[model samples]
Target: MYRYDEFDRDFVSARVAQFRDQVERRLSGDISEDAFKPLRLMNGVYLQLHAYMLRVAIPYGTLSSKQMRMLAHIARKYDRGYGHFTTRQNIQYNWPKLGDIPDILEDLAGVEMHAIQTSGNCIRNVTADHFAGAAADEVADPRPYAEILRQWSSLHPEFSFLPRKFKIAVTAAENDRAAIQVHDIGLQLKKNDEGQIGFAVWIGGGQGRTPMIAKKIKDFLPEADLLSYVTAIMRVYNLHGRRDNKYKARIKILVHETGTEELAAQIEAEWAHLRDGELRLPDADVARITDYFAAPDLPARAEGWAELAAWKKADSGFASWVTQNVRPHRHPDYGMVTISLKPIGGIPGDASDAQMDAVADLAEQYSADEIRVTHEQNLVLPHVALADLEPLYRALQAEGLATANSGLVTDIIACPGLDYCALANARSIPVAQEISERFGDQARQEEIGDLKIKISGCINACGHHHVGHIGILGVEKKGAELYQITLGGSADENTSIGEIVGRGFEPEKVTDAIETIVSTYLSGRSGTDEAFIDYYRRVGAAPFKEALYGDKAEAA
Candidate 1:
């Protein structure tokens, strides 16, 4: 929760005024659609298939209860009654009128949020581990560095309008919850042998038509040299990255074409000139930013441990929810509660305005008045005391937010496919809904174990299907929708791109195909202890392919 200063407020207010003028011009016919296209995009507005879509940035996925309330207000007052939480931890409103967007932007600016850099080829919102400040195993909170990057890159003259969109992710936890490997630039904060903090820099990782894991360009970049090093990488890419084709414009493509060694050398050469210059972060500034993210004070709640055990014994439903949605926190007396937006058979990440309001109330009452949006399309109360669990669960249940399917098959991640996105080939929501309903049973989900099923309407990988344990990609073929399946992909520390199992299945057959894959995994796994990903890695995609396509698997 970095509070905006006077300068920050003035900056955002000025941008809002500028966009308001632009929007007015477009509406007044002073500017044609062609002329206003780039202007609208820069302000985070997209002309979708049916209506305009507005993407609001939730930087590093942190939100105050007040901010959450503002989001809920926007949803209730402006567009449809709900908002879609995206894989990037942002939110999208699908049915906003073009004229009302500036008013919406003004509302967002009032809460220190905006739509800037949420789209376009500039560095998008700098994301970090949703569990950054609360994770038990974090070396340091990554949000401060993320905020620093945000401040530096916002409207940066040099890096703006790059060959393609750029994304950067940072994580301090060893578990890699941020999916840093699949970002244009990934930073893993770690302590050196001498106990000095730094980052393990990875560049060129991305997913689209060409999915590639980022390569480690620097083993250790001093925390102070973060900006300098990152700028060097950007300079290299900006100079050489392809501009002719949007298909091959990402830095990942440049990394593939230019050898990693040569690229590293170029970055180093650039860094030598800038490392000790004005870009170097001073310890005082770093400390000031870090202070903004200091952990909340947690009074001892030791009695909750006993109370929680008794509550679990009394209610199986509550017990199941605790087992699924809760994660260990840095404080033993507290837990990180993931409020699953993906209810069984419900749209994966769509939250109604009332639900958002309810979550805000619960966060203020039970948690520390803070909410986190996960890349998995879930909301998190990161500092809920164990004692507050029962009431929080009950409140969330009433709001229909307590699904108890955090990492299960029912906790699906999908994009706004053909239903909303003009670039989409087929509908993603229907497929996600069908799969969720198929495995809606709690017992069945438990049997399936931890599984991630990501679906994208097209090859853009908006749903991160490339890294899903069971990925579903929708493609158009011969005037029909075909769903392609990829198995064994993961977005964790040991990141790997999934392999296509076989020929694409018809929309009607996709659910059945997914069921077959799950059944095959259950039967082939050595024991329940072996997760789907582990088993798939152990045996490769051959078994799933065979099960899906039968004897024709080889040809596929």
Candidate 2:
């Protein structure tokens, strides 16, 4: 993880004090609600349904043990005893009092963390692949570039106060675990024929009332030209992006209204101005940031196949957890262990304070003192020794974090819907909970294979429901909570937005509809090896629709 320099430290300290003053003024009635809205939003504080919610940025979703412990401390002291990890790989405190926000921000700054840019229409948190440095197929670590962007966009006077929120994501892996295709600006780190590094830039990708996959603007931008290129894109959006309507204010809308070619041309024209200016990233600076993310000093050891095999034979439960929750690492002797927040019938991505502390302890002892938050709403011990699997599982089980359903049907992603957010139309957590309980059995989940079910209360797409294999969006229709289902959506390398199957189902009938869809897939699939996504792509949504709405409705 990149440690904060003197400038970074001083920057956060000043911002905290400023926000503290702002909060005090609002509480003292010196500023009205409308007057304090932007001020509080700039600092990542939101007035939710029942209380104020604070979103703390976990930049690139990387955390040290100390930072994790501080989050646990905040969860224990300020709000409730738990925090909700979000699809953006950030954490949210849902019950923080308005007066306590400044203190919470101060505590976060103490651990080199903050809530800045986590909200508002400005550039939000810069995210990256969860297994960035440790992934077996990574071309290079993307965090250095992400950190560079973070520094550049932090409070850039030019780009702040855009028409709507901006999100940027980077990934070096071919798998696209970071969902680059669905971001405002998506950069894929790649090496060209000459083995020089750069990025394949994509723009206009987003999901809301209108969903879109980003269009490729640049095939290969040079390494030194990254900052200038991104600046060009931003300049184009800031100048021409929609400002009259909040609904169409996103850069994605601008790209949609004006074609990609024209957008790219405008961006290029803008880049011609700033290409070699002060915005050009220097080689020495890039190298300095890159050095901060060098791989830890890990010793080489033979694969622990014999011991792991023996343990698996002895304990079936451990074996199940290992099979589902473990990912291959760059180093053969090590593995990336995913601590699933989706226990059977539990809320997705909700980690208690005690669980956070326990994960920090486990990371320090078993992993290399590093933790990662995934876009799928799970935590990762990015570099755990294969030999430590049994003990790690035991510790995680003790903390109520040992769910063996990392990518299965039960591993759901849900947003804080009507339960917390005032913008929500219906409840999302209970829907997720019901579906989770429906497929809670390990054997049934294993039978379902790698299926992602995402739920959002409304069309803001905070839950990333647009990209799930089975996307559920809860809507209010005729004074009832109805769930709309979309099939074949995925956020992987071959990203696609799901298609709506039919009429929305009532809340009580949602679980049965999901089961019907799953049953249809199981019956139509070529084999178990064919994942839900691949099968859906092959067979189309016909059978699933028929299963859900019957033959005449499917034909219609």
Candidate 3:
């Protein structure tokens, strides 16, 4: 919730004016399609298969109720009646007219938001843990550092046009909810032995055609040296990262080609020259940023504990919702409520304008007037009082937002595959919808336990299929859609890339294949206590492969 200053307002206003002129030129035929490509991309506009797509940045995934209202307004006025929330915690409007983009940008600027760096080969939106300020186990809120990075990297001349797009994620919790290990640069905030906060820096982690977990380049870097160290890493990558081939242009590729030791040495050498320089952050500056993210005051609500127990006893539906969508907060009297966008058989991450508006109203009335967009494509009210749970649940239910499936099989994550994305090889939404309907039963989902099923239309890994417990990739073969399955992949603290189980399945067979995998896991697991990921790791891919492909598992 960092408020924009005069400088920010002026900068955004100026950019809007510039883009407005560019858009006008394109519409008037002064600029051709090829000429307008990079300009449009820089402003977060994409010419998709059907129409123009506009991606708006929600930095660190924090939004005020007022801003949420504006998002709903955009959906209602500019494009379709709904928008897609992405894995990066941003939102996409799939069918906006080309001429109206500048107006959309202006509208966003009014709320201190923009689409800059949401696309292009630059440092994209700096993301952090959605529950940063509210998590019980956080050493410090990572959003302050993320904001600092945003201020530093916006329109940075040196790193603006890198070899390929760059992403950075930060997290202060041990649970790794932000999937930091899969980012180009990942920062884990931790306290040292002396009780000083710093970061464990990881670089070269990404998930495209070549998925690699980041390597820890520094065990613990002083908080003051964050910018200097990060700049050093950027400098190294900018100088030596692949440029001739877009396929291998990411920093992860460079890390693979150049040994970690040598790369770390080079970064350290570069840091030695810049560590004590102007880039070093002062304590006063850090304090100023941290003040902007101070936790909201919460009066005691001890009576809610007793009241909540009574309510749960009275209503099983309410009880189920509480059990699934509610997470423990730093405050004992408070809870984090996840509003699942993936309703059974509905499109994952697509929220109608009315639903968005309803969430905004609920956040204003029950929560602390703040909303968080999770990397899992869900909205979170991070500081809801336990006493307010029932009313909030009822309001969300009325809007069809209270689908008690936070981490279940029905809470699937998918990209805007062939339906919207031109780069996609096949459709992703129908597959997600099919799988969601198959496991829509609450009892059956509970039986399966916590599972993540991520699907991507292509190898771009937009849906983060590489890290799901049951990852599905849709590929085109012989001019037909084929879905590939990968098992045991996870995006938690112990991150691991999923392995392909066998040959790709036809679109019609993909759901059945997923059902078979789940059945195999249920039968093979030692007990219900053993999660799908744990069981898969324990036994490896042999059993699931055998179950999916039968005697031909070895060949598969």
Candidate 4:
């Protein structure tokens, strides 16, 4: 993780002091709610149904042990006993008193963290692959680039207060774990013909009332011009992005209206002015940032196949965990373990203070003193030895962080629906819990194979429902909470938005409808060789739609 510098330190302290005064003003009645709204949002404080919620930025979802322990302290001292890790890979405290927010900010600053750009219509936290540095197939570490982007966008005078919230994601791996295609700006790091590292840049992608896969603006931007390239893209959007209507304010809308070719042309023109300007990255700067991300020291090769396979066979529970929870690390004998937050019916991304503390401890003891948060809202010990699996699992199980359902159907991704955000039509977490209970059996979940079931409370697509193999969006029909199901959607190298099956289902009917769809896939799919997404793409949504609604149940 990049340590905060003096300038960064001072900026946060000043911002904290500023926000403290604003909170005082809001509380003391010097300003009306409307007057204080933007100020609070900029600080990541949301006035929710029952209390104020504060979301703290964990840039690129990287954390030092000291930082994780600090978050645990904050959770224990302030709000509820827990914090919710989000799909965006940030953490949120559900209830923080208005007055205590300043103190909380100060506490976060103590560990070199803050809530700046966590919210508001500015560029938000830049999420990257959880297994970033450690992923075996990665061409390069993406976080240094993500950090560069953070510096470039943070309080940036030009791009701040854009059409709507801007999100950018980067991934070095070809697997697309970061869902880069669904972000406002998605950069996939790649090696060009000359073998110099650059980016396959995609812009204007987003998931909201309108979902769009980012169109490629540049096939290969040179390594030196990364910042300038990004600036050019943002500049183009800021100048022409819709601000006349909130619904159509995102860069996605602009991409739709202007067409990608014209948008690319505009970005190129903008790049002409800035590509090699002062904002252009020098090799030395890249080297400096890259220095922060040097790989953890790994021991010489030792293949422990018998020991690992024994652990796998002796403990099928741990085997299931290894199957889903563990991912290959670049180091031959090391692996990354995902601590699933979706434990049965609980909130998807939430972790108690004690759990956070334990995770930090485990990271320090069994692995390097580093932790990572995933876009799927899970935690990762990025460099755990294969030999350390049993002990780590035991420790994680002790902390209630061992769920073992990393990418299964029940491991659903849900937004902070109507319960927290006033914008949502229905509550997404409860819906996720209900679905989890509906398919609670371990055997049943294993039977279903790898499936991504995501839910967003509203059309804003906060939960990324549009990309789930089986996507569920909770909507308002007259006054009731109903669900619209979309099938065959994906956010991978070949990204595509889901197709809606038919009429929406009431909350009660949703679980069964999903079961029906899954059952249809199981029965009709070409053997167990087919994943849900592969089957959907091969046969299309018509078969699933017929199963979900039947012939008579088809239309709205």
Give per-residue CA lDDT, model 2, range 94-153, as digits (tens): 999989988998999999999999999899999999999999999999999999999999
| lDDT (Cα, tens digit) per residue for candidate 4, span 1-556 | 7988899999999999999999899889999999998999998988887788999999999998889999999999998899999988899998888999999999999899999988899999999998888999998999999999998889999877898899999999888888888988999999987899999998878888888888887888888899988888888888888888989999888999999999899889989998778988989999999999888888843654556788999998889899989988888788889999999998898889999999989889876898999888889999988888887998888877778898898889999899888788998988899899988788888888989999999898889899999899999999999999998888888898999888889988888898899899899878887899998889997787677667665573
Q: lDDT of model 4 at residue 549?
A: 62
Model 1 segments more than 4 A misplaced: none
Q: Per-residue alpha-carbon lDDT of model 3 for 231-350, expressed as tens digits?
A: 999999999999999999999999999989999999999999999999999999999989999899888899889989999999888998999999999999999999999999999999
Clashing pairs in 3: none
lDDT score, residue 60, model 1? Answer: 96
**Regions more than 4 Å wrong, model 2:** none
Models ranked on lDDT:
3, 1, 2, 4
Each candidate's root-mean-square deviation in Å? 0.7, 1.0, 0.6, 1.2
Residue 23 in model 2: lDDT: 85
**Local accuracy of candidate 1 as per-residue lDDT tens digits, 247-352:** 9999999999998999999999999999999999999999999999989888989998999999999998899999999999999999999999999999999999
What lDDT would candidate 4 get against the real structure? 0.89
Count clashing pairs, candidate 1.
0
The clash count for each model shown is 0, 0, 0, 0
Model 3 regions more than 4 Å off: none
Cα lDDT for residue 120, model 4?
Answer: 91
